[model samples]
Target: MNTRPLLEVEDLRVSFPGTTGEVEAVRGIGFSLGREKLGLVGESGSGKTMTGRAILGLVPPPGRVTARRLAFEGRDILGLDAAGLRRLRGARIAMVLQDPKYALNPVMTVGRQIAEAHRAHGRASGREAERKALELLSAVRLRDPERVARAYPHQLSGGMGQRVMIAMMLAPEPALLIADEPTSALDVTVRTQVLAILDELVTARGMGLLFISHDLNLVASFCDRVMVMYAGRILETCRADALSQAQHPYTRGLLASLPRLDRPAETLPVLARDPRWLDDARADA
Candidate 1:
């Protein structure tokens, strides 16, 4: 078995210039990833999304990103030039954003977009790209992929659009995928199906997945490992199966707030916060 990590981040931090001073969006968080599904769970503004963006060097301008060591396959990603980072983005590491309606092109056909993605990576010719696109559409379990490919993005349902996003991201067969809430917009029933498709593809390809979401219940069940974030830092890291036994007060508070179907509570508890969780960054659980 290959023991080396696919990606390793050490002391990663992102901050933006504010009126008062620098606002730390991601505060010195670090982790390593192999070919496994890892979930980052936290409430909004907890810096989960910013952490994902930083990996791909997608942190917007005016915001600065710094790390002690941001290496992918043992090479320093932080040192890569624009050209090198561009090559790595879709070809080696891809991101599937929350909504396809915003991510996909408004003018391009879904087939053209997929083909373009493949061609951008120098993976195939126009003809072969289109063929591959059709194949991927089917792989995502889209019905009548030929017809769907010819259609525009607006024509597809929310679920179908997300599948299209997945198909596009998978076109390059990247080593790692950063999915930032790819299913939040879909319906409850469709959410399961989309997750099933994503899970199946990621497992078959042996790709590392960094799934970022706010739903603790979904992350507990869907991911192999889970990291609980609060105020720009990971407070706990534990096996998804063992989330119920997580020792951190923040993790426990999150679990307690969830509505249990097995034993329904009269009222869901509100999360009580502590100031020390932000000040002290424990190494790990």
Candidate 2:
């Protein structure tokens, strides 16, 4: 197995030009990813999704993304042109978004959409793409692949739609997958199923996975390592099994806030905000 990281980021900063001044959404943060599951946990507006988007050059116009170093497979992402990034996006890296309702094409059949992804990279002929689409649908554990393939996005349930989205992303056979709250919209049972599929696929393919979500318990339980983010900064990075032993106050607060069945609390404590934490240069890894 290759010991080198699949992606490396250093001092990554993303900002938007605003009327008041430049608003920094993602403050300077650094991390590296190998062919393993790495979870990013934070509340909304903490810049979890933006970090993932910035990695793929999807920060949109007017939002400036800069980094002291940002590289994927030893290639500088900051230097990749439109054409180069296009080839790299879905082929070498892919992202699964929060909701399939918004991610999937409502009018296109599931199979055609998956086939389109496969063909977009010129990876296969039309027939081959179609075959791969069905294979991927099955790979995601969707029963009756033929029927699901013929169905439209709206015709499928939230779980099924998400499954189709995953199948489509898998069509490109990406080496890295950035899943931004992929299971947040699904029910508990379905969420478990979708994650199981993701776990199996990533492990079997030896792909690197960046799992982004706000669920602290979920990240601790599901990911190999967890990065706790607050105010666009990573306060701590620790092994999943050791999340309870996290030294950062923010991480401890998050863990304490989780509702537990075994030990119930009358009320969850409000997370105290500290401006100094934002300026903390130290990362407890």
- Cα-based TM-score, every candidate: 0.97, 0.97
Candidate 1 runs further than 4 Å off: none
Q: Rate the local accuracy (lDDT) of all candidates.
A: 0.91, 0.90
Q: Model 2 residue 114 lDDT?
A: 96
- Cα misplacement distance, residue 100 of candidate 1 (Å): 0.5
Tell me how far the alpha carbon of residue 44 in candidate 1 is from the true structure, in angstroms, after superposition. 0.4
Task: For residues 1-285, write the lDDT of model 2, one tens digit per residue.
Answer: 688888999999999999999999899999999888999999999999999999999999899999999999888999989999999999999999999998898889999999999999875899999999999999988999999999999999999999999999888889899999999999999999899988987788889999999998888889999998888888889998899999888788777877889888899887787788787645533
Root-mean-square deviation per candidate:
1.2, 1.2
